[model samples]
Target: MAVKVKKIERKKMPFLERIYIFYIIAGMARTFRHFIRNLLNTKNIEFLEYPEQKPEDITPRYRGLHRLTKYESGELKCVACDMCATACPAKCIYIEACEVEGSKEKAPKVFNIDLLECVFCGLCVEACPKDAIRMDSGIFTKVEGKREDFISDINELSSRKRGDF
Candidate 1:
């Protein structure tokens, strides 16, 4: 079946509208208004000194940095199933499985998540059958220098404690 297409009349743009003069002026005016308001009331402005000042608004469900959970015996909860890596949409998670010395289960010898590439979607946490990985560190990922600094290794992830957050 052939679909009937509707022909709509196009409005002719005026010289000022075509040039976006009014839109630009409106934007500039809004910017200047905010600037003037801020300038006049500097004390009213609230700026959180991040890293030093923890945001009070961070809810319980806030997905922050990634961390690996440990068992009561201090061993990592991860079983090297590669579920998290498989579920990651960004393909940021990397895991090298090693056979545990005394157990039949495998453990991650080199579990690493590149924070730079991570979307912080919490999919890895959900996909894990062991509940090994979590994004509830409450500490926001921050890297100042070196791209390699953003990669969180197994040791770093496991070392993160609940109190640290």
Candidate 2:
């Protein structure tokens, strides 16, 4: 049975919520803490110049930018079971599976994820049963002028994971 939800009447916040001094104080405190820590231990902070000095040693479990995985045999690892597509809250992932000879499951013939459509919420990564998709590889692909170029294939995504980028 469906329950009807009443329309909520939103009210203006109190003067504190509106002015938000508490939030400012908290942020300032955090910033001051970081500032003091950095001042004390100059080499302790992990910072990169970005685009110029990228972090060379990211943790293995670090949640990286994004990646579509592949098997070591040069075959696509994604089974195209639609888990990623379904799991995506943005509904950005699309898959068209095709059968291979002697294979019980179907592989993606046309697998596309719209970066413009993706929130990078990591739902797709968590949904992958085979660990065939991961965003923890420490590699980030650049978006191009052509929207179609952002629709990366398993092969292209896999090649980057293959180490010779």
Identify the leading candidate in terms of lDDT. Answer: 1
Q: Candidate 2 at residue 112, lDDT?
A: 76
| Candidate 2: tens digits of C-alpha lDDT, residues 28-107 | 99999988999999987877777566667655665655667766676777888999899999998888989988979888
Candidate 1 structure quality by residue, lDDT tens digits, 1-165 = 999999999999888889998899999999999999999999999999887888888778889888889889988899999999999999999999999988999999999999999998999999999998888887884855999988989988998865344
Please report, in order, the local distance difference test score of every candidate based on alpha carbons.
0.89, 0.77
- Say which candidate scores most in TM-score: 1
The alpha-carbon deviation from the true structure for residue 117 of candidate 1, after best TM-score superposition, in angstroms, is 0.7
Worst 10 residues of 1 by lDDT: 156-165
Q: Report clashes for each candidate as comma-separated counts.
A: 0, 0
51: Cα error in model 1, Å: 1.9
Off by over 4 Å in 2: 1-48, 55-62, 141-143, 162-165
Q: Stretches of candidate 1 above 4 Å error?
A: 1-6, 163-165
